[model samples]
Target: MTGAAPRLRSPPRNGGVRHSPETARKKSPPPPPSSSAGGIWESAHFLKWTAADALRLPVRHPIPCVLAASLLFFMAVEYTLRMIPATSQPFDLGFAATAALHRGLAASPRLNTLLAGLNTVFVGMQTMYILWTWVIEGRPRSTIAALFMFTCRGILGYATQLPLPQGFLGSGADFPVGNVGFFLFFSGHVAASVIASQDMKRLQRCHLARLFDTLNALQILRLLTTRGHYTIDLAAGLAAGVLFDSIAGEYQISHKLNH
Candidate 1:
């Protein structure tokens, strides 16, 4: 390994899209507007779907809209709470008080591994949900911007020496798992795209992107309003992990298929 970065392969297509009877039966809807920055209140926003819409989606599979909205809220709450003066709020909580939540949930090695794995999946599933939304919403420009920003931050985990909030990047760290967060997030981000674009599987790609764009846009607004760097960073680590893992997962799948 000479530090060469892995190049991504464009997701392949099965056959060129041929409108079928089903396509012809349904009237083509009006093109969706360009997604605005996400917020719960924004009507035209690409990422912000209503609670009703989410409830309507089948829960058998993970939903990006729900995950993004939930993560964004958690980030906003935990981070904002810490900013309140201990004297005023009577809570000595720092920005990362939530990390302690992990302490209680993790038990034996098996439980620890389970939590770590689920946390990683939760992050990626959220990303995938957002991607799914973006695709549905006509592939707005904001989708690309959010993803680009996420990718840059996610890759930085490899070069940065600073102690990450999640802790477990290398070992002997507060978070023995955080060491790998960057990889999980970055790879998950790329993998989400690859998964959505897989050959004939491209059916879901458009919807996914639309959903993601709206969710991430709202997340930005939440971050701005709350200004919780630690909380946001913690949330980001999870988001980032999902992106990385998704990418790694895709690569494995692709490699398996190629061989």
Candidate 2:
């Protein structure tokens, strides 16, 4: 009889055998979290959504309309307040006192011009980010809401302005805009920077966010040293930033719930 065929040893049940291709494919873990800015830029939804796409989307609720009306109303109030004359009613003296510390620099026309130039550059950068992330991302509602808060802050700032009983010694020259003294109750520049920084961070633009945050800090300093705004003004602007962020968050939640 032919020698019995050597019995092939059955594959050991769990002898560290290599998995089949199908099993290996199925068990592969999901991709790792992306940490690079380039990755974020490529994956940004804003890059995909076009303006026409945004327009075609139906309004699921009236919140946006209401927000629009509120924005207009606040703008009207701001303009009205600006038209009113400032008064001699005394308020806090902290801003003037702090500005006194930088009197020499504040009075330097060259320094002032440099700061203005820097401001213009940063403002342009901020606008670009807003258009790219908010407008293109189909989140125009959030943008509008933030603008409403800005208007509200302006209204409050103008309403709060009172003629400094005694002008600050060595304070920088008046801004180009005549009658801006009445608008000195709050610093719109600082507030705007705050809002822009938040927007950048929300979109995962960490570098931009950090840069804007530094700009915001500088703006707060500018407002104080340049005497463009009172301490209360900067404080109010910061508060407005917080308020606007909250409004944007609420809008997002409401929209999510509605959908």
Candidate 3:
């Protein structure tokens, strides 16, 4: 029998490299899927903790955790009270404080405008930080706890639908009266700022805390002059924020100990 003819392999077209199945199989993995819109979320994956993560979290300070939860519960009750529609039975120092601040700040339009603008900035920053802390911690329970507490605050404000303070915006009339705009029973801005501030203090306890604290104080004062929050509303908001922060802190501590 004649010797088998030698197999002739085709050369690469135009001298280009050709990869065999084996070679292709060994090729480096396809670049990871492009994250696109999820890039930001992916960057913070470290903070995203699941239920399993919570289960693994360790308890560092069980007592503080319990205490914080208790305070939060009472704050929820107080929030409910504020939510009630402006009843003849309930009283607040909003009128006096709002009027006084409005009059006091009336002379300096520039000053009032500056503070109002600052308040707007602070409110936005506070929101970002609150969400940031929860997400960064990567705990579902902590996030849920925060959301629940904040939701309570929102419900109360909407339920009351109390008119904005006459002093707000140099006169209540100046403020565009609207269903949402006039939801002034409790100052969500102040509450949110305070909560963010306290959390920062607990977590970082340095420049960040001081920054947040200053913003919180400024916001509380400005709410009366610009946001139409009553003194009682501001007070309630602060209490709610503090309570929420405490609860969140304890929850995180407990979770950490488990891990």
Candidate 4:
């Protein structure tokens, strides 16, 4: 005891520097692991519900969210023009062609839906490009660009609705309810793409077939409730395909980017 040296304690002053084991133990908890991402995804998800609530997608993109809204607007407008059966004026050529072809697959509703979904994926990709290049590209308009694109499409759609063949796009065959149903499906896709691009990146390589499967079930639910139509199955199929593929594609892109 006589040989033991006095324990030296550092002087503490008003400089406010302090340390403690308890304080060390109480780390900031790593920011709660971000249960969800903010910014575009939050915007997309919110806008989706907002659009659904409004019953009209007016193609108004706030600055924070661009690509998804743009895709929805341009694709909806362009695809509407491209797909519906035509006289001389335009609807969607692909939609019309697909609709015509879909008649043959009426016997196999499931198969037809699969094909329609695949077609929708292509349309989505092309639509994205159009916005990236002509509408929003080189400019940072982002979501606003998409909103503007939608406005343009809306204008075009209204114009074509008048001059274009009223077969499906304009006709009751246009299926307002069916259109709304399809819009719901498409809305999920756009929202998923936005979220996936942001938050799901962390979960990407995680195999989301479960999520895809969930979406498939939802589609089936929608299908069962709706009146029977030749394109219904096809449209549902397209939505599922796009949903699954967007998840898959996003994972791939994220992997490439991360690596």
- What are the per-residue Cα lDDT tens digits for candidate 4 across 1-259? 4787989987775476676868867864655434566654665755657546554433344442566678889988887764535445443333454454434455556664554465355336434643453344442222333343334434543553332123322112222313343322223333333322322233452444344445444433333323222233335334533454444445556777999
Predicted structure 4, TM vs. truth:
0.23
lDDT for each candidate structure: 0.45, 0.66, 0.65, 0.42
Count the clashes in each prediction: 55, 1, 12, 21
Candidate 3 contains a number of clashing pairs equal to 12
What local lDDT does model 4 show for residue 115?
44
Error of 3 at 25 (Å): 86
lDDT of 2 by residue, 157-210 (tens): 577655553444222333333233456555556666677777767779899789
RMSD of each: 24.7, 21.4, 17.3, 20.7
Give TM-scores for every candidate, taking all chains together and pairing residue i with residue i: 0.29, 0.54, 0.51, 0.23
How close to the true structure is residue 38 of candidate 2, measured as C-alpha lDDT?
A: 93
Highest lDDT against the true fold, candidate? 2
Question: In candidate 1, which residue ranges exceed 4 Å CA deviation?
Answer: 1-103, 134-137, 154-160, 164-232, 235-259
Candidate 4 — number of clashing residue pairs? 21
RMSD of 4: 20.7
Which sections of candidate 3 miss by over 4 Å? 1-100, 107-110, 136-145, 170-182, 249-259
The residue pairs in collision within model 2 are 186-233
lDDT by residue for model 3 (141-254), tens = 334445656688779877767654443464322222222344565666766766666665656667888887777776666665564666777788778777776777677789
